[model samples]
Target: MAQVYLHTMFGNGARAMQEAAGSRASYARMEANAGAADMLTDREADFIAARDSFYMASVSEDGWPYVQHRGGPAGFLRRIGDNRIGFADYRGNRQYLSAANLAADDRVSLFLMDYPNRRRLKLIGHAHGSDDPATIAALMTPGYGAEPERAFLIDVVGFDWNCPQHITPRFTQKEIERLTAPLVDELDRLRARIAELEG
Candidate 1:
């Protein structure tokens, strides 16, 4: 909790596995030497702002773990305070699995990824749903098609940057267009030159 993400993530089983794998001592040293892992810095804020999607994990009352994808326009998930983040819960299927799970257990885990850049951020936090007009407004994205039904406010307990191993690079439509703009322009120029020569 003080300065370690694995403190909130790694339990006895995880530690035992690390020990069996002969990596427990290194991880123990990491926990001891880590910086403030629960507080969000400008770097983290920027990363969160650039992300349009993330996976939220919750634990049901029945002890089953549920993972759901939450997404919107970039920066929908914004940092509130140094230790808090919130996002407007856009209208979806009537089933409120995430909201119900939060009511039973406030603890949540989040996976924020940047596939194109092969960057990943993992977070552990406590979250709750709020229907307050102000809270909802703060997290809302104006002119977005989806109607927000509520807001999920999360208190950060720990966060860590994950390794990019095995993450396949992918680009969104907008990103693909941006990356191919020069090629498109050259093609258009060639077409114009051919038309001029034929004339």
Candidate 2:
């Protein structure tokens, strides 16, 4: 399974290197055993629900790759189907590089990271953009405070989970507060006990 992901990544040169490293046979075994799915699993859906941002990559006609960070309220990226997802394209610096690139080439890649959990997901897809007001409205995040310029829809080709080898665990402000709440409460209790003893 996951032939698309492996095939796209492993060109002749890459394959040659893998062969030299004796990994080609192992990768071949993996490809034979692991087939790609058109739909997300329940776990993947939940992971997507918890993500507030992701990095997207698009390619220009000239073959240059552009990476952009897309962020909003959690769950801003709406899954329309098992194999489909979309988001409201909010107004930004107006570079329109991604939109322009998509016009030339539909292929796209996405990287979603959960730093605290040290998990990452990579997705490959073809993207379509729509300026239809209804579509934009449907995808827009209700209280995200961004103006929707259009809607970006992705028809997923495949997805893969990456190993957490080098990911540095980092906490957001909200995460830090949630994780330390119990400790803070214990500190308060200890202080109160000390005051009672002194009295």
Candidate 3:
């Protein structure tokens, strides 16, 4: 219900374009009416908890932006506070591109997609990586196999739920199983009934 995300995303040029189209006034009105909060709502926290992966965008010193996919067990990204979330940065391909970019500029954005449900959340924030024991412990999931090299903290600026209009529905293996489990059970029962009748 908030337009903080839109306000931050739209620049003067963008607003000018919208103005030429006579949409700026309507957008400004909506922005004024929106209740933007610095903290994540309970529903947002729950959505973040259910996500297993997210795409992180970082800008290099050359001004080129790179999007890296980070994933782990479900709930790897933990909500540390009302307005902050963190995750353990496990050792990966050794590219170190994201870490280097973050050092130069902390501003980053995250895209979390729940494809099966056709939902998505966009988060803009500042992120930093640290090897501090306390931070790592706070973010790391004990049962997750990967050894964390450092803890990554995201101080959320704001987040927005995206329109699902073009997001084609897709299901993960786990989601597929969960959805078809009852049907599988029913088929097994029918098979048994046929076998018993033949005997």
Question: Could you tell me every candidate's TM-score relative to the true structure?
Answer: 0.94, 0.93, 0.94
Model 2 lDDT at residue 64: 99
Off by over 4 Å in 2: 33-38
Runs with alpha carbons beyond 4 Å of true place in candidate 3? 33-37
- Best by lDDT, which number? 1
Give me the displacement of residue 129 in model 3, in angstroms.
Answer: 0.9
Ranking by lDDT: 1, 3, 2
- Model 3 C-alpha lDDT versus the unseen true structure: 0.89
Total clashes for model 1: 0
lDDT of 2 by residue, 9-119 (tens): 668998899999988997877666545654577777778768999999999889999999999999998687878889999999999999999999999999999999899
C-alpha RMSD between model 3 and the true structure: 1.6
lDDT of 3 by residue, 1-199 (tens): 3577777777899889999999998778857754555469888899999999999999999999999999998899878898899999998999999999999999999999999889999999899998999989878887888889999999988788888999999988888999999999999999999999999
Minimal lDDT window, size 10, model 3? 30-39
TM-score of 3: 0.94
Whole-model lDDT, model 2: 0.88
